[model samples]
Target: MIRKMELKDREAFVAMANEFYHSDAVLHSIPESNIEKTFDELMAGSPYIDGYIFECDGEKAGYSLLSITYSNEAGGLVVWVEEIYILPKFQGRGIGKEYMDFVEEAYKDKAARIRLEVEEENERAIKIYEKKGYRQLDYLQMYKGK
Candidate 1:
């Protein structure tokens, strides 16, 4: 089951987030600096971000953090799948497909398009997304951080 993230799910969020990014040496051993406040605010709910916790067989399995925005091109709300993390042990069991399907049902009426990005080298993830009908865009992603 996929449900709205609660402040009480902070530990799960932190754990899954770190595990998901474990390959990034820079963040491997780092603690989340604002997860407490972040989870609190997110659980409070808003028009912007939507965070969900996925449970499998009555246990915490993973999460999906989404960002929503209006897009003239999309002709409705566009949502970015900022992150989706499933515990290593829970992977390769079709849980991801179910989780994504849940997201679609939850936002179908409110969103025009759902999108996500994967690391260029993560071939497994790329294949999964492709199998789910996601395609690569011709545009490059450019970003600036302060």
Candidate 2:
């Protein structure tokens, strides 16, 4: 089942997000401090973000975070899929699609476009996003050092 996230899911969400961010694959876990602050901000109810948690038989299994932003170029709201993940054991079982469908339903009236980024080398994720109708962007995503 997929449902809106609640405060109680914080710890699990953080663990999962850290796992996703800190490693290229599912293993080689990193120390908590590496992602603690960002996780805390999400838990604090960051205004532009909403989280959806996936549950299996009443236990938290995975999560996705969506961030909505207004795009002057699109002339409407755009949804930036900040993060979407399924535990390795739960992947390839249609849960990720369901979670995405849920997001589509949830934002049906609010956005003109939905966007997400995948590592160029991550073929599985690229295929999944393509199957979901996302296309290559005209520009690259660049960042400045902190």
Candidate 3:
């Protein structure tokens, strides 16, 4: 089951987020401070971001972070799936697919697109995403952050 993250989920969320950023799934590791800030923003009820905790048999298994933005190209709101990480032991149990379904169902009426970034070398995740009907965009993504 997946549920909106709560204050009580801070510890598990931090642990899992740390593991995720350090794992091969991401290009680089982020400081724990960043994770803490994200948690603070979420708990503060930030409208720009949302976080969810994934549960398996009543146990905390993983978490996802999403951001929302308006996109002229998409002609509406876009839901950016910032991160999704499931513990190694819990993989292949359909949680990833469940997350996709959850996003689709939750935003079908409100969003014009659901987007995410995946490392090219992460074939496991690529396969899952491909099967979910996600396609790659030809435009290069450039970013400038403070």
Cα displacement (Å) at residue 145, model 1: 1.5
The C-alpha lDDT values of all candidates are 0.80, 0.78, 0.95
* RMSD from true fold, candidate 3: 0.9
Q: Which lDDT value does model 3 have at 87? A: 91
Pairs with steric clashes in candidate 1: none
TM-score-better candidate, 2 vs 3: 3
Which has the greatest TM-score? Answer: 3
| Candidate 3 per-residue lDDT over residues 35-131, each given as its tens digit | 9999999999998899999999889989999999999999999999999999988999999999999998999999999999999998988898899
Give the best candidate by lDDT. 3
TM-score of 1: 0.87
Model 2 pairs whose backbones collide: none
Residue 103 in candidate 2, Cα distance off native in Å: 1.1
Candidate 3: segments with Cα more than 4 A from true spot: none
Q: Give one digit per residue, the lDDT tens place, for model 1 in 1-146.
A: 88888878988898777776566412234446655555666877877888989888889988888989999998999988878888877888887888778878888999999988877777887887888889899888687951
Q: Which ten residues in a row have the lowest lDDT in candidate 3?
A: 137-146
- How high is each candidate's TM-score? 0.87, 0.84, 0.97
Estimate candidate 3's alpha-carbon lDDT, on a 0 to 1 scale: 0.95
